[model samples]
Target: MTQSTVPPLKVGLVGFGYASATFHAPLIAATPGLQLAAVSSSAPGRVHAAFPDAMLYATPEALYACDDIDLVVIATPNDTHFPLARAALEAGKHVVVDKPFVLDTSQARELIALADARSLRLSAFHNRRWDGDFMTLSQLLAEGTLGRIVHVESHFDRYRPQVQARWRESGAAGGGLWYDLGPHLVDQAVQLFGPPATIWLDMEQQRDGALTDDWFHAVLGYGTMRVVLHASALTAIPAPRFTVHGTQGSYVKHGLDMQETALRAGAALADGWSADTSDGVLALHTAQGVVEQAHATLPGAYTQYYAQMRDAILHGAPVPVTAESAHDVLALIEAGIASAREARVVQLRGQV
Candidate 1:
């Protein structure tokens, strides 16, 4: 495949809710190779309010039919992700599906197969992998500063004691904390340590009126190493972002990176945006006393995802987030649900 990097690709987004409005639009607008060509939403006002120059479609099907759009980004809800993405690929467009790529492994695999048959680029928006704290941990692991990490812990906790009346809190296909936040934790674990031998999951609805699980605790077993991933909306005081233990020493980091907040607050992402440090605390033990490092907060670069997607489409660069990797994440999520349902450990077969 002869890929050219000189030309930018036209990108049509399929939703205008929080994910699209807050995350997708800004990043797509900021990225160089991708233009915000069109968007589909019944809430045309929402799309028009944010992207006045972009064409507006009444439905995703209409968006997919746009001849000028080179890429399609599905930032719609969880249940609609698979079909919408499949439609885009079948329409000969490169596709980017937001997190939890789909509700099940079969859906993910099907999309993979379809994308492959068409030779089109397919990617998942596993953006949390680029979170500042995660990057720091990845750096430490790469440098062997943590020295053969035997244990890893990641938490995405919040203080929402009351379950809000939203689709996410509803007892539906993609509802609840597990589907909402599980992908981030699972993907991070997979990214750092590979797949696990088994997974032990404890999921429950902690709030009084909640219909779905609001809390989740999963232990992904990697033989000698164990990764403990947990998320709860009831957490008033959130736990550390990362707490890693290795044979030689340990490293602990507190607080989520500020880029998401910055994006939500409409901050411009120029001037080394991701390299900024607003929140990070790292403590490592070394022979030269306890080596402590505070990561210069990296600007969250959601735009990088689109840039990579553009490269993959125009230049045949590797898709930043592949469908197969996302399938594995869905498998783990299914296994987690099963583990919690049966009150037994889910035996995972894949390695990394």
Candidate 2:
């Protein structure tokens, strides 16, 4: 069969909130072989602003029932991720869920089993792996520019003095900055260095009117290498996004990836966006002295996630972010939570 003859994969986005509007809907629309078939949102005007011709359903189930929607992208609250994904899978549709895949590893395993039994594609949206800075850092590590790894620090700090009124801060089962940002950090670390041997965590509710943890510090041990993952809502002074110390020297990067910021600013597609401006400073120890240079980050393309999702559904390719990998990410998150509550390091011998 000819490639062009196959119909475009139709996607049903389950929400039109910040995540759906800012990330999923736009990326799905931007990809060539995928179409925004429908959306389940109470705010039709909001969805119409972006997808003028696309269908709008009053509820997600209504959108899922339409055979036109071959895939369902769940961009709802953290607590709803599990049930919504399960519903989408039961409707005989492929699924792509937002990160922190679910509250625990058990839920993730259930979803994974369902998708496998149905012979359908299922993936978690660990889209931060495509962040320009992260991609560049991955390249450097692969090329051995950083020599043997020693220590790593990753921060996703932000300046939010006042805790806003949202479900994320409602201290629910899967609320707080830990679930919101920890998934990204933990997934990135695993991508770079596999799973860790042990993890110790400390979490706090530092911001005013904060009901849940707004700050967290997690230390993960990988053999001799130590990986520290942290995120806070009370940082006036921003920390470097990444800091890597190796035998050769260090690579310190400041500023977050620009793609999310740009998409929120209403860009059509964040392609070919340069990273020269927010380059990471790479320092190497030399015989005479240390040499420092700015390392350029690869352009971030979140569009790749949907593109690969399209391929996996249409061409029988491997899923972009497998449910099992996301399950592993959840293992680390749950471990961190346990570590914080018990005030001890959690071993991952059988956890993952």
Candidate 3:
């Protein structure tokens, strides 16, 4: 059948929170081969405001019960991810859970096994993998422009001084900066260089009302290469989005991707928005001395994820973020927490 003749995959989004509304909902709606058919939200008006025609359900189970929903996207709290995903998978629907795939690797492995047994597509929304800066950095490394990478630092710092009352900050089992932001940083690192050999972590409750760790610093060691991942709610001055050093020299870039901001402001999802960042600076060590130049960042196409996900359902394409890859991310997160608690470098499983 021709592309135009193929039917769109109907997706049921299971939450209307910041992640769902700001990222998942609009991206799914804009993808050519996907439809935002139904949503489960307590506030129907919230879903209707952005998607007036979308079918609304008061509870997630109700949405999962709809046979029309070919795919279920879980955008709920960290602790709720595994249960909601299991329920959706048990309902015989393809599943997509937001980042920090699950609270632990065991949960991720269970979902992976269940999906494989049922022959269903399972994926994680590691959207930051498509960030403009990351895309550019990937290209730089691919082209050997940075020579052999030796040290890398990635930060996702924010400036929220006062902690809000939310499940994410409630000191729950899966609530903390490490679980909240570490997945993105670690996933990006694994994308550039495979899983690390060891990880050392340190976390702190820096904010006044913080019941959970609001700041975290983790180091992933790969042989001679050392990567530092950090995030904090109390950061005032901006840290480099990425600071990568190689035998050639270093690459330094600042500022977060603007796609999320644009989406929050209701910018129509389009290819034009992929150019969401400024040129990053590259420093090279030359015999003459030090040479620095501005390197153009590539456009970040987050919409590709939903488009690819649609193909995975209809055309049997590989999932945008495979379940195994997300499992690795969660494994690293668990290791980081253990490292913080034990105050030592933790060796990653199956890595010698």
Q: For every model shown, what is its TM-score relative to the native structure? A: 0.94, 0.97, 0.98
- Identify the candidate with maximal lDDT: 3
The global Cα lDDT (0 to 1) of model 2 is: 0.90
Better of 2 and 3 by lDDT: 3
CA lDDT, every prediction?
0.85, 0.90, 0.91
What is candidate 3's lDDT per residue for 94-207, written digit by digit as tens? 999998899988899899999999999999999998899999999999999889999999999899998998988988988888888888999999999998999999999988
At residue 88, give the lDDT of candidate 1. Answer: 92
lDDT of 3 at 202: 97
On the 0 to 100 scale, the lDDT of residue 55 in model 1 is 96
Clash statistics: count for each candidate: 7, 0, 0
Error of 1 at 264 (Å): 0.5
The C-alpha RMSD in Å for every predicted model, in order, reads: 2.4, 1.3, 1.2
Give the number of colliding residue pairs in candidate 1: 7
TM-score of 2: 0.97
